[model samples]
Target: MASPRPFSRYEFLIAWRYLRARRAEGGVSVMTWISLIGITLGVMALIATLAVRAGFRADFVDTILGANPHSTVSYAPSQVYNELTEETYFSPGTIQDYDALAARIAAIPGVTRADPAVRGKVMATQNGQRGLGDVYGVSAEAMAALPGVVDPERASGDIADYDRGIAIGIGLARTLGVGVGDRIQLVSPDGAQTAVGTTPRIESYEVVYIFSAGRWDIDEARIYMPLAAAQSFFNREGVADEIEVFVRDPERVDDWTPQLLSAAGERGQVWTWRDAAGSFLAALDMEDDVMFVILAILVLIASMNITSGLIMLVKNKGRDIGILRTMGLTEGAVLRVFFLCGAFTGVIGTAAGVVLGVALSLNVDHVMAALNALTGGNAWQPEVRGIYALHGELRAWDIFRAVALSLGLAFVVTIFPARRAARMNPVEALRYE
Candidate 1:
């Protein structure tokens, strides 16, 4: 008679029967279940972690770009920081023609908005409360164009008379117990010199608006006053401390740098957002790599359980393997049959994990809200998290990575056990039986 083809119908039929273990094979069945559960949990956790990491990074970068300038121009060297006020003190006429320089830069092709500003740190006082405030002196038009602030959704007051009043952060407003229409005092230490000494310049402006910049640090420390008012406050009349430049695409900072310099001419040098935040962005990338490595190890550990289970199955089925070999089954067919059993378990487990992980990512926010409500505590504060809502971004790459990791591990570990069963000595295996 002709030898049976590889993995013939009878071989599959026999493999299926063997997988449905009898009372004598109860221990093998338990091992199979444990292996399947382990793979499923590992894949699920890996995918979920990736989704959360991706979401967090995207949200953080978006907030940074939205609430802050993409680039800054000042009458100082590129190495000089944007917050440096000493540049203005040393070279009073370096950026004296700020209005014209700003207009020129604003007309650049990729430029969106170029707003002259004066930034300073001062003491804020209201209702007997005191806190340090980061004050920005910007024009009414620039203040209106400021992204994330003066928004109808987040702002509590109007900017109709912005020059006559100030726009403060909601966090700062809360801290100082001030609200729209209330007066808050800003005390600057850099006042005009007198015969005896310099006195603190104390000025109070009505709160025209209260805005949230979506960042706890910014919302807790920023204040926006009119350009002319800010100039006078900083003793910088007819000149701006610096000009903030927003672009159409922030990633094109390098491309726009030359054009910005040309527009700035001899007036000022360009300082990019990256100069201010590159280190922080690099740190985030490092964090992502670390998280991925840690979670991948979890998958590796979980997949090891498959090795134990398959070894047990091979040992318990030694007698059956001997009978099959004597009955004309090829060694290759025996290996294929056992391989299918393990492969089936891994594929099914991985599919179920993908489903569970995706579902969890999609409903993470709702889950967080439900848990917060059930616990009746206020631990998840936007001010603490720097974002108003939690988000999870599921990606195709994440799912593929999880599936490939699980399936690859399953196939590799299945090899030795399947080969062992195939190479069994029929006489020796049957002698024990």
Candidate 2:
């Protein structure tokens, strides 16, 4: 006896024949075109939305990490050591046991580097321009370990002296209208009166190195000086405002915080970037959630097209269903054939959408550039900085989720139509003119 034809091949041919017949009908029914368009629009919207969210999260994280240390250890009440002012010339609080604390923290599994830092708020003035910026006094070696703290070639010579050198952010420098060899006045909050009763506590330093951390916050208001200078300015001797710790992985911030606190002893509290920038981070997360829900509606509306298209197919194929049932084909097989046809439409539409979405995500910058040219002005400037345009990195998980959702929605839309086709009475369908 001849072997029965493979079920897979038969199913494939049946699905293809139906698909081709629909296409050849010259002007396919409006419902069919609508369904295809719906799937295409839904898939494209999902992929694009996910890509933008991923990009925004990445860019925001980079900006935050660049501006602040991964984790910091400071005295709980007030980390600022206020006793060792330049006038008092008194010894300030020291680590008490610096070497021991360092050793204990370094032994922790994920600790990369731990260094002392002097933090103070100071008013910087260049010519008539003035701004309040953080003055971070760090050891030369410690400066090297901190992220985004590098001396640029143009200003290296200014900082060569070390004693009178100060590094200012590029944006800050621009606003102040100062550069290498320019004099800038630095005023500390603490001032003391002389024996005659006149307050005298102002100092001037030459603008040395200009650093750019690629973040508006850092570039707009950050200054670095030698630990000793900061110590003298803040009157904190042998003591530091905080101990900055670098970790191997930022995601493990909470894991390392407790370890740092233990090592810092009872006098200090450890704070992560997330803790310091809690509100900002929370806002970012909220933004992501809102965007996801809003964009998902676009996909949801597009899926309706799939439902309408499948209903139309069921009506168009009524006669085919009757013939197949009379030929001894089971209701289940008839149902499966139409289900496969709907799924095929979803698959093709989703594939095309993925390609289009990925291409758009990757070239978002170029697209913005063209728009800017056409508009003769900067448009689509959602980035943290106005200097550059926004671009999103496509994520694999996002793509997978998008395609799965599209196909799943297609399957759901096909069910009722497939079932109706299966339930058609062969005699009645055949009797109809």
Candidate 3:
């Protein structure tokens, strides 16, 4: 507040000279450039990796919730898991009137819609091909709410009216070598009990539509048919296995449980989308955290180069420090000079990394596509069992965190060397010169 120009200009000028000086002047050394580059790469890697992880988590959650409902109003059994099969138990003790239950749920606040459905695993055979898939019986209203239907027109009408038609995912359709209008045989594991023994219940269904649900698991193994057909085929007339409910805010699904449960009545129990897929989501988050910790070590290693370079710089500038001190430069000013030099590297490196990381993250999909084209193969394809594609999302907060971490380390490492340079004895330092 006293003088606007009270800050020392000499320190910064000297620091700038040191940063730009060539090897001949014993100012900027090879180690300085190496340190800068190392920090840049480390920051870039952190941003890119974190961005990809964030994108994947978001995509995974969206795909999972999109293909399925946010919450399901089902007859709660003793236990519940993600996988659904024909042999999976449906609690007979709960309300069998799915229509009434669904209506009740739909009337709840924060509830968007509800649709009754029957789900089970079945063996599908078409032509000479055979595949195992999960089949769902849903009303037209319910099917319309599902995600990733390439041709909604085909699925918009009352699916409950079709007694001989079925909708299948694109992957399942491909595997069975069937298309729209093609006939496929579905064999349920829950067989009929005759005098001889239990025999598999088989039925032929004509494929009326094909859909891509974005999720590999769903796309590869889900089929939809009329609710009445499913109920009849499964020998559970006048009852549905579950009622899927959509909410206004899927993220806060847990908050709406009490209302949904109350509407579902005492015999009914509810399962949110998170309940079915929470474990998988948790595993992804854990993997991302581990990757972050591992990548942070690389940044730490790069910071070491900054420390080593600063130490060397101080040693090389010992004679200069002695001369400057004798010329009335304060110890604090001497400390400032070296600190600025180190900070220059850290700041520039962080800036460059942020730019590079953002550009790379935004264009990663295009870059991978180009690489695949060049290689004539899908080199960048996701090989995980349930993952269908690679996704990327860049959060500014993540970049901020990475930048702060890198700069903090760089700043901390600079202090020791700067202090050593400041504490130098003028007489002893000049003796060698």
Candidate 4:
């Protein structure tokens, strides 16, 4: 016979022929299909899981930082270092020129808006139910801008319309058994001293509006009123506890934080929302990493099927391997033939998995909504809502990483069996069959 055709072309053709052969023709076996299915399922799970986690984090973070300022500029007494315990005391002695300070911060390139606010704890009691909550003093104009925090559209009365009118969270209203036109008694934790000793400042505020920020923590434990009203009520006027700054890109708060802090000078300290929520966000990141590793193990387990299937293929194709070797098929070409068998399964499985996973991730919200409807429950929403609501978002990097991990593992697992086939002695392989 004339010289055998180039082994390169023949190697691929033979591998494809073997892969496509029916069981009757001693072709593609059940184990091959098992490996393909296993890889597809593994990759799909990994991609979808990671995408959901990423989406949940993005949605939750955005809801929080969007409703709140990206950073804050505060000037408190040096002795009050602990925010959790020490009350924010902005006495006239500690007060700074808020207008000038805000103007300076607003002048920053990335800074979009700056507003002064006073935050303090107050007790709310209505309809025999009582609870402690945080009260924020903000401008009516600023209140109109953040609907999640205080929606102007939903309010029947302006925060400045009434001296003691306030916007309350919807959850708080429910808990207090009150409504938009109801009155709630507020007792400031720190109030004026009296002959009876240091008594709490007590006042009544009409609930002009109710806001639902999709977070139970904020909705049930926070309220907002005009800065002027808060100043008069808290007995601290011509001053604010802190100046809140909003930047164009909240995600890049780090880039603008230092500059804003510098403008505030030594009298003020800067705090980004990220810094405030660092521990919670860090826990989320750690959870994502752990999930990735755990899901990656699923792909690794699936790849074992590729290894087993390839070994079985080599055994079944022993006689064919011997004949090919006798016909001048180089050992490397033999190795490549078996390698291609496993690689094709991996490639096809990974591609299918990626498509399915991405599709699921993109539409997961709708899917969840449907499931919840069917189940007659609010399964899609959080049981213990905090600073944000539940939502889904698919990131490109998540898919890329999932696909890379799956394919890389699939390709690596084929090496051992391919080498075994290449090292087989032609005489022994042929003698058995």
Which stretches in model 4 have alpha-carbon errors above 4 Å? 1-10, 20-28, 78-94, 150-164, 370-389
Q: Write the per-residue lDDT of candidate 2 for residues 1-433, one digit (tens) a residue.
A: 4533434567767876776654545233565566677778777777877787677667767666654678887765534445566343333334645546766777888888777788888888877999888898887767665556563542344445555688888878888898877888888757664686645357788776787765666777788889888877777766777777778888768888877887787776788988876787688678767876765666666666656666666677778888888887877887788778777777888888898889888887787788988987556543344223467789898899888778777788778877887888988888874
Off by over 4 Å in 3: 1-7, 25-28, 77-94, 150-164, 191-193, 370-385
TM-score of 1: 0.88
Give the winner by lDDT. Answer: 1
Name the 10 consecutive residues with the lowest summed lDDT in model 1.
85-94
Whole-model Cα lDDT per candidate? Answer: 0.82, 0.73, 0.81, 0.80
- By TM-score, the candidates rank as 3, 1, 4, 2
- lDDT winner between candidates 1 and 4: 1
Winner on TM-score (2 vs 4): 4
Error of 4 at 181 (Å): 2.0
Residue-level error in angstroms, candidate 4, position 122: 1.1
Task: Write the residue-wise lDDT of candidate 1 on 243-360 in tens digits.
Answer: 8999998877878888888887765588887887789778877987787788778767766776677778888888888998898778998899888777767887888888888988
lDDT of 3 by residue, 1-433 (tens): 3422322687788988877757574534777888899999999999999998898788888777767889887766544443656365544543477788888888988889888888888999988899888888887767767665534643333334345588888788889987778899999978798999888999988887787767777877888888888888877778888888899999999998998878877667888989988898899889888988887889888888877888888887889999999988778888888998889889988888888988889987787678878988465543353656666799988999899988998888888888999999999999967
Which pairs of residues collide in candidate 2?
A: 84-235, 85-235, 94-238
Error of 1 at 276 (Å): 2.7
Which pairs of residues have clashing backbones in candidate 4? Answer: none
